[model samples]
Target: MTRETVGIAMNGVTGRMGYRQHLLRSILAIRDQGGLALPDGRTVWPEPILVGRNAEKIEALATRHGLDKWTTSLDEALADPSVTVYFDAQVTQARVPAITRAIEAGKHIYTEKPTAETLDDAISLARIADAAGIKHGVVQDKLFLPGLLKLKRLVDSSFFGRILSVRGEFGYWVFEGDWQPAQRPSWNYRAEDGGGIILDMFPHWRYVLDHIIAPVRSVYAEARTDIPTRWDEQGREYKATADDAAYALFELEGGIVASLNSSWTTRVNREELVEFQIDGTHGSAVAGLRNCKAQHRAATPKPVWNPDIPATEDFLAQWQEVPDNAVMDNGFKVQWEMFLAHLVADAPYSHDLWAGARGVQLAELGAQSWREGRKVAVPELDRTGK
Candidate 1:
């Protein structure tokens, strides 16, 4: 069987998420695994051209990855007809312009989430891509996680007859730069750099709820700036203008209520950094990044209120663990393979630019809800081409 190659011009590979998730773990991993196999027997390999502003850094990464292509100029890469697809993982503020150029150049586009800093920009890009008839997608990596997959299976199989409510907790204590060097980039604390807990996470919450559970109709959010001051990479003090924490409630289509808390200031007490507990009429399930546990209505134990007496039943122990019944791979890689296949084979790709635009809209509305201290409605997004 002949192995066809798909050339991907990868921008913003110098950043952490771009470097680790998209470049190394996904695109490179796909190449390492001998490409994706099609039913017709042709295999497609992804050939990546690393694009960044730093020539030396790009060159270094290209060499490290044993790649033949590296470029400081984006236009140089864009001009080349061989580069069939363009992937962006740049900062939020820079996404729109680059994506527009890529779309204008007639390249299929895939980008990291919060597709644009503004919801309108995201929608405009979606419209452009629709008109251009180019394949487009946004990173919704959480959907492919093992735990979420298990949860999806349960929902699909009607194990949960009718989901009533959902509670999601996602957070970690980020170190203050003064004592321990901050794990996240210094730019994350500045609103000017397009950094906020709500912006970073609400899109994820939107898609997670819409896909796994039900479509969200409205959101009530409260965003907070917990740590006002933080040290930068140089140990210099800087003011954090962005919200570090956000608490939100989502109203889904089927009368399902979802509450989510996202914070960089919180400490972990659960099995994973992110966890979701969904309650249905027949059962309830709690899912983390890699594992899920469930308890059916039939298995529910009755426990009387006890403050004076010692604890009777071990409540947490009653939930049965869900077995890993399916093969799971790195979430980002799985999505990338799907996107590549979408480009070549014209395979079904639902997570397109319209989905990305809707994510942006939800984030925008979430901020609106936070600022106004009221619930904001989310109308159904018109998927222009799809």
Candidate 2:
């Protein structure tokens, strides 16, 4: 039995998403499982080298994981012939250059989303990877999310026939960095660092709508900076120049409209940070982070607006929770395993660079629409095989 071990260099392993998703949950967890099963009765394991900018931090992570391979030098890691795959979870501003360099070095790539801040940059990277004839992927983690997956199943099975529209609500009150030390990086609140809810999140929506329901043809959006100023850990105040909230309207190719509200300033009462409601001709379903509930035509509520009458109860009771069908894992980790399989075992994987570029395109267009107060047309990509 031929056992294949693919060497992967993981960049930005010090960050929250990088450490939890890419390293501990994906690589280490897969290692613990003795790697993934292959089609030919073989096993494919990932040999990962954690890469970052700090020696002590990387050393500590390596020590905690009982892995000796780590480095602060990206060029050195990329030059290593054994490192066949390059994964980036670096900050948004740093991703394109790093991934481009890795691609030039002939490494297959996988990285977290908003692959590049601009549509042009994302397309350039996609073109580079295609021309290089190397495998590439992006982290569209939301598609693998259990709740969203369940929702997709309903759509696929025609449970929600003749889909009408979708409404998305995503956000939470992020603590002031000075008082509570924000859970996300300070850079996430700064515009210069490629930060903003619109850019960070709309990409997820673009793919979700495209993959699950329909492709977006145009977008109209309005964005705002609700928190104009925030204090850092040092008790120094900084003027925030990025939008903390965005409300967008999308026109899908199939005439299914979608309305999305993304904000970091709002309080959440939902099951997860993100929630989606789909209304169709036959039924409607609501999905949160870990659960999905639906009401078919047979279960649809009958109601009339009456000042004194109590709301109908049967429809609420009929909303059924979707059962968990697969073993639960971190959403990010699920995508990582798929990426590794695609690289090492020739397993089919979506969320490739072109898909990622489309995400960037949506974000860029959304921002353009907000800035100009006009609808933005999404350009089609040339998906012809290279």
Candidate 3:
């Protein structure tokens, strides 16, 4: 069997999501597993060239990982023709220019969501990448989660006949830096720094709803900054200008109404940090990150509402657990493997830069809806970035 290697210039690996999920879990995991196998009896290995703003951190990361290639200069990293793909996980404000530079250098693009701070810029990047004729994709890892995979299977099997509506709840309490250190970076709460729950999470909901249920046609949302002040990593107090919570109602095609509540301040009372319940005429399923429970129409529990009486029903126990027929891998690693296959073998990949742009569009429109106090229509975008 023959083996091939592809160089990936990974920027912003020093960041939390970048380092933990992409670098360690996905890329390094693939490398440790003897690379990605192709259908043609060949294996493709990933050679990561770590890139970052801090030279000391970059060098230390490379040394810790036992990898030699790293650089503080974007130009220097992109200058190497062997680096066929440029992956970005940088902060929102820094993404557009960095991605543009990488595109200009004729490299395949892969990056985190909200590809650009604005919808226009996101569309521009999509158009530019398309015009350059390169393979591109955005991280839509949630779609690959075990729970969502089961939901997809149920949908494919027509389990939810004529789906009607969906409800999603996602959030966890983030401590105020004063009493306890904030788990997230302070930048995530500053509006000027491109921090907001609507911007951060609406993209995720957009993809999940669009792919699993139906294409989102409209959205009505309200955003709020529940915690107005928070201390930064340096123990300095800062005003939280960004919205910490968002409640949204999305109207999708096929008359599906999806209501999602996203908040960083709310305490999680459910089984997982995030969960989505899809209800239809024939059946309904609640899906978290790893577990999914379904309640068919035949198994639905019915009870008469009576005030001043103790309830006898155990509602939670009514649903049956969905079995994992196969082993589940890390969602990030799964997407990474698929991307590699698409790059080397010309496999089908739908989550391109344009799809990423669609996510940005949804977030922009969600914010607009919040501002205007009305539902905003989501127009379809074509290849020309219209």
Q: If both were scored by TM-score, which would come out higher, candidate 1 or candidate 3?
A: 3
**In model 1, which regions exceed 4 Å deviation?**
384-386
User: What is the Cα root-mean-square deviation between model 2 and the actual structure?
Assistant: 1.8
Candidate that would win on lDDT = 3
Number of the predicted model whose TM-score against the real structure is largest: 3
What does candidate 2's lDDT look like per residue over 142-222, in tens digits? 888888999999999999889999999999998777777776676778899788988899899989999988889999999
Q: Write the per-residue lDDT of candidate 3 for residues 176-242, one digit (tens) a residue.
A: 8998999999999999999999999999998999898899999999999999999999999999999
Q: What is the lDDT of candidate 2?
A: 0.88
Question: Alpha-carbon error at 269 in model 1, in Å?
Answer: 0.5
lDDT score for residue 256 of model 3:
94
Give per-residue lDDT, candidate 1, residue 378: 93
- The C-alpha lDDT values of all candidates are 0.92, 0.88, 0.94
Residues 161-199, candidate 1: write the lDDT tens digits: 889999999999998899999989888889999999888
Off by over 4 Å in 2: 309-315, 384-386
Angstrom error of the Cα, residue 182, model 3: value is 0.8
RMSD, one per candidate, in order: 1.3, 1.8, 0.9
| TM-score to native of every candidate shown | 0.98, 0.96, 0.99
